[model samples]
Target: MTTTKALLIGQRRRLALTMVGGFAGVVALALAVAVVADLADIRTATALTDRLVPLLVFYAPAPIAAAGAYARCGGPACLTVGVVPALVFATLVVAGTVFGVPGVGGGDAPLGGVTMSFALVGLSGAFVGYCAGVTAALLADLAGFGGDGGDGGDGETDAAE
Candidate 1:
């Protein structure tokens, strides 16, 4: 009986999926920031990075991460959903800004001074998405949407058996 219950994901699994998505988004955003930073000429790269990296990071990755989590984890959600993204964001910040990866991550000094603007933004977005997904899933279950009704979406009916 492949019912809605079967389709429903556990809280732990949903959280895991959310974290995975968030990590993927954060990593992609970090790479983009680095690439963008390196796009400018030596004379203007620092200025461009200082102005652009933060915006790109703020606008791009957070949504991607949140969407991934929301789509996969339609459950009550968990702490990991937020923690993973935050950790990933913090790691990237430390690596890109603190380690001073020359020619990337904004480098040292005025070059790499933009990531801090939205360090928590990505995590917060993922958390919100996860929460929404959880609420949606719960409401669906409450509405009896999870029941098999002897007819799963796959077209297989209990009458056939």
Candidate 2:
């Protein structure tokens, strides 16, 4: 059986696909949440907005980045795939603070607090992503996946390699 090795920079197509897929995954989730947030008729014990704000601001980006890092297993795609989702959520937080979004802007909190919170969230997302990437790389190494030195993990090594 022939083996295929994955490369970070040398292989263009697979890298592009993963990058696009990661970005799309983040966008799709944001759109889904937006659709849910826009509905006025839905009733729940807790306002969906109250629950979903945390989903958007904290839960979503970190996991997505982590998953991307895990999937990439050691590629730059880890950062590219992870950071977009993080920034998307971060942007929403900043906008919510500036525009007074209910359940999001924390109207009683000082603007400085909002800034610090968003900054923390954003940095945490990226840092967590990096850590995940590191973990994935270590895991790949343990699995004997990285000794090949051509690719990280997203599957399909370059034919030329």
Candidate with best TM-score: 2
Prediction 1 TM-score vs. true? 0.43
Candidate 1 at residue 33, lDDT?
55
TM-score of candidate 2 on Cα atoms, chains taken together: 0.48
The TM-score values for the models, in the order shown, are 0.43, 0.48
Give per-candidate clash totals.
Answer: 0, 3
Point to the candidate with the largest lDDT: 2
Off by over 4 Å in 2: 1-41, 73-76, 81-120, 143-155
Q: Write the per-residue lDDT of candidate 1 for residues 30-79, one digit (tens) a residue.
A: 55555555654454765656565555444444444344333333232332
Q: How close to the true structure is residue 101 of candidate 2, measured as C-alpha lDDT? A: 66
lDDT of 1 at 25: 73
Candidate 2 lDDT trough over 10 residues, lowest sum: 1-10
Structure candidate 1, residue pairs in collision: none
